[model samples]
Target: MVGPIGNKFAPIGDPGRQAYEDSLQVFEEVIQAACQQVGIEPVRADQIAVAGEITDQVFRHLIEDDVVIADVSGGNPNVMYELGLRHTTGKLTIQIGEFGQLPFDVNTIRTIQFSRSPRGLIDARNQLERALQVGLLEGPDLLAVTRIFREAQEGAADIELSTPDVTVETSDDDAPGLLDTMDDVERRLAAMADNADEIAAAIEIIGAVTESAGSEVQKAAQSGASNSVRLSLVAKYASDIREPVEKLESQSSEFAEHMESINDGVLALLKMIQSSSPEDRPEGWEAFLDQLISMAESSREGMEGLNTFGSAAEGLGSLSRQLRGPGRKINAAVNNMRKAIATIDSWDRAARSIRKPSEV
Candidate 1:
């Protein structure tokens, strides 16, 4: 536990003394009680028995704790600083605050909010227990800042897969850092779903044109200049599908990102539903679970199609020199798409893991 230790609980006057006492009550009754219920030992930095620099102790606690319960009440600068540092580790972090007092910057992230009343404290305890249970089951909640590092790691994996047996040489060390915001990345991913249809259509156009043109080119190669005019006419169609090639190039990365987005959303929803009290859950949650599982299964078909199309493009490129350039471009787009889809297979397992609190 980390928060509101120095200035916050310091006895400045009668009012401040009462506030400090009340803070102690909340810690004992709400936070520590929840930890005991979850069978976990709760530790606070100020209560540490070991002698060391306070900063080192706090940092060790924040980094090494199996779980960190952070109280953001009164927006204590020290607490906020510690919380920021904790977030960097992407460890199990549970944020709680006096009701309505969560820092504005982090208000949207999942937090256990509680009133100062006795009843509110009880509710907070129950909620925290459930959160810890669900967190242990699902691992840490994926924060956007921490998520960027994972995404970069996945990008490195993409580079390796794109080059087949060869070691891919790319500087992911310089890859753009934490996205502008999750909302922007999510919005771009949403656009990716729409682009998938367009890309599919473009793939068809390119595939159909290549196959028909390849037959002529094959005959021309066999019989010599007799089929030159036919080759010229058929070859022009590749240029006609230039727009499609460009679309695939532009949108394949976005297309793959949608899969990752879905993976994140699906897991988040699963955790939310699993952690929530029965009264708080939406109707038809079971149906939603089924749908999420189905979505994961459905994604595989698209992945298979794109992969097959990529291989087909490679094959067609060999059939005619005219198609070699465009085939390579489309194949590269396939690499981008595969990169996004590659890491999202976790959603399949996540989908299967969905179960009620009783089952857990």
Candidate 2:
């Protein structure tokens, strides 16, 4: 089920209202596409048979719908209230809104961001579809999990504060010197490898927390909550994802550069092979083939890493659509990385074909 359809959510004006109408129309498109992507029957309150009052219909849908899509744009109170009702049931729900339109309270949630422009609408639809597929498969109750964890942490902190003189012991072996710290880079990398399986899990948790905050923001906005209150709610959520997005942007850019360097080297070797006679072929061509094989393997690994970080960055970006933020940079970085990977793979294949027994 989806909500805040028609003019009830729009502002009272001419061009401004028209823009909202157009954006909402596009959002509906996103919702329909999301249903198709996840292979679910699309049901919304507006679509239901008018067997009774509209309120009753909305009430039933809020509690019973398999999935609920809420548009929190313009701080629409009705949609926010309906979304809150859906949450109480703990059923699957997804939130979406325009860039810079969602309330700061709900801004922490990973909303599928859209623009009023033609291009923006198309991008929003595609993103909403992907998000639905993921949400359905993962069954993330990010809001619920975050709330439980937050309450638990608060309770634990209270208990610790009340209990004085609580201490733990550490061994001399646990201490690391400057040399050990300097040499820990490889160990850190190894630990990252070991922790690879946890990336998706961590992303899920972060997304849930963000989404939870978004819902709260929506609710508070509807209640005419102050800016300070909303800002406070999002502070922790923003900090949680912001640093990761920045780090990802840096790493992905560096990775793309590496791939470009490798790409240039491979093209040079390929040109050399194409122009050379068999007798005049580079002496170390055989060893170069081995290195190419290694680079191909690394490229594949880089692609996987890019994909993982890209997904997280995309969610974070959706959370905050500032021009310099991860939401924008993540997409560019991911696209560049993908192009690089494809080029590298093609070059790998070409190099291997040249090294074939028939070619020799």
Which candidate's lDDT is highest?
1
What is residue 172's positional error in candidate 1, in angstroms? 22
User: For each candidate, what TM-score against the reference?
Assistant: 0.44, 0.41
Report lDDT (Cα) of residue 307, candidate 1: 54
lDDT of each: 0.66, 0.58
CA RMSD, predictions in order = 25.6, 24.3
Model 1 whole-model lDDT (C-alpha atoms): 0.66
Q: In model 1, how large is the Cα lDDT of residue 325?
A: 75
lDDT of 2 by residue, 1-360 (tens): 554555444567755567556545754677676668668866666667777898888888788777778777776677777876676666677777777787644433446666777787777777777767766776754453344346665674332122324333348887643334323422432333333323334445545665786798899899998978776666655666666545555555555555554443455455555456669875666655555555555645544445544545555543433423645565555555455555555556666766776642
What is the number of residue pairs that collide in model 2? 5
Q: Per-residue lDDT tens digits of candidate 1, residues 1-360? A: 987764354556766566556567768998899889878888877788898898999899998887899888778788888988888788999888887676754543456778888798987787788778768877875666566666765673332122323322447776432232334434544465466667777677767866776676677777665565755755785676677787877777667656655554444454555556667765666655555455444445555556545545544454468777777787678666555543444444454565544542
